[model samples]
Target: MKSYIAAAIQMTSVPDLQKNLVQAEELIELAKGRGAELVCLPENFAFMGEEKDKIAQAEVIAQSSEKFLKTMAQRFQVTILGGGFPVPVSTGKFYNTALLIDPSGQALARYEKVHLFDVNLPDGNTYRESSTVMAGNRIPPVAPTKELGNLGLSVCYDVRFPELYRHLSQMGADVLFVPAAFTAYTGKDHWQVLIQARAIENTCYVIAPAQTGNHYGMRHTHGHATIVDPWGTILADAGDKPGVAIAEINPIRLEQVRRQMPSLQHRVF
Candidate 1:
């Protein structure tokens, strides 16, 4: 079957690791119970805190070894994509990384946030992500999936750059994951549009899980977790709340759309 059930998990992450993990576990279980074969969590699913202060608590990938990611994938017997965790790279540098775990709880791929969220929105939501988060040099596209043919891995802010999605489409990615923790100000206006645009342009399914509601320190995120089909159709959407948006990833439909439009082939720029 070309169709697979997937879930977009939304949550308000806090600074405490245990608290966020608990929430993640609960939501993952809920999604599994609802028959989700592939579940995705929001950006900074572990901890979302202040600039440099947060980086101090970052963990090394090798030494830390994602216990929560592995446990959830194995327990649910589903593929889990844990979005944006702070991982220490060197003495001071850190990477905002996402991990993709297989049903067997094995880590399939890791994609660091190539484009950091470094913007000062008019609503006083100022962020300087590059201050502590090291930039990723590589663009990881199309991680292998048992259900979806090839899934492109991307995090928040990265969705703004169409070139990334174009590259992934060129790499034969049928589905793309864009887990984000966008601020309320920007998300309200740009989130859905960007998502649909990506899906339509690439002729691929876009699965975007987001952080909704107020988080730790009263920081609010624009939650409207959405799943868009290749035709720019919003299959499932979650408004300003913490919940799951479940949808079916149909590769055949994607192929049909690509065959009809063939935009990826018509790219001259």
Candidate 2:
């Protein structure tokens, strides 16, 4: 199969949804210009605030998300992997959603974040994503399209669980999407290692977009959006800045790696 390029967009989102969309639009254009056929965005790329605060921003997504992403993808003729958005299902509760838009401007796949970040950090920051964000029950592998290859769709906290990636790889995933807004404290130590490890073990490509820098309030993230190859090579690394990490995804290389190791086929249990 022929090789193609993908992009990972890093951002620092605030409380304003419009402003974040504008920034994302510009970055998407940049990725297109870089010849990125598939572009992924970071988690919470729309609005980042308290659980109750996101609900207020949730109602507008159903309309704006499709309209805006569809237009952008169709115009660019590139597959756009939209970042996480808040979709309200009930009063004061919403699911963190990730969408994949085809070049034809249709949402081909939508995967809600299965794992939520609910923990206390060394910096004394406590995040209870379950309080407002309802976790998704299903794990949908992004079906292969003519433009983009087979992808396993997932969100930020999901990367911590290798079992999920193993299942995805077994399900015929050629690539993996791990869009996250990793906190500064944890990311500083564990981010790159985990991302590379996933790719190496699964023998599949990994595309990870991230939120970087300090936000509207005291919130901060370690923004190192990156792409990894099947052999655990760091293909592209977007340093702690709002930018795009562009890299080529070669199916030939993926096959070569898998053939060399054959670990997936040798699994006993």
Candidate 3:
């Protein structure tokens, strides 16, 4: 794997699908212009609104999101990760899916979010993701690439689960993707810490694209789209804005950190 720049794109997506796509394209262009070869978009890049509204338009959102990723990757000549989007399932619910597309517009990997957020926060915000999103039964996949190294996939809430990233590290992942629309209440406290912990513990670079600001109604996300190195250093942070956080992903640095820490090799259980 060679060194290249990666981007974590932040956006405040609303209920409108086309508007969100336009916004995403602009960010992608910005990242590409900044010399980012691997660009990632935050969760709900296409549509963010009431759960009922999301469910009602799942098919359209799914189709549009997929098409947008492919088009962006091909046009920009960069590998693109659509952090999370709703893909319809046979049971009338959708999977919160993260998809990776190569520069040639082919899908490299896909991950359906396994963990569902079902909680009532202290701020009086309630979320029942399982009501609309069917949890993935299998573990997320790590896609091996000659130039990009092994890339692992996971969604927003999954960042709280360390074992998933452990599995990816065991599978020889060099980088982990945690695309999220993390709630503001939890994000304010847990977002950066969790991401850095994953990177440090697994000794892998982490690219986390995030949604920030108020999407609609009471749904407010903490926006800090970040790229972290293997040693848990914050490379670039797009703080609470609709923008791109660009950083270098270097194999030499990754190997150096792994050899220095040797934590992954020391795992016992």
Error of 1 at 242 (Å): 1.2
C-alpha TM-score for every candidate: 0.95, 0.97, 0.99
- The lDDT for every candidate, in the order shown, is 0.85, 0.88, 0.95
Q: Candidate 2 on 129-204: residue-level lDDT in tens?
A: 9988889999756567654568788898899999999988988888999999999999999999999999999999
Candidate 2 at residue 107, lDDT?
80
Single out the weakest 10-residue window by summed lDDT for candidate 1: 56-65
Q: On residues 1-269, what C-alpha lDDT tens digit does candidate 3 reach at each position?
A: 99999999999999999999999999999999999999999989899999889999999999999999999999999999999899999998999999999999999999999999999999999999999999999899999999999999999999999999999999999999999999999999999999999999999999999999998889999999999999999999999989999999999999999889998778787
Q: By TM-score, who's the top model here?
A: 3
Off by over 4 Å in 1: 60-65
lDDT of 1 by residue, 110-200 (tens): 9988998778889887787898889898987578665667988999999999999988988988889999998889888899999999999
Most accurate candidate by lDDT: 3
Model 3's number of clashes is: 0
Candidate 1: the clashing residue pairs are: none
Off by over 4 Å in 2: none
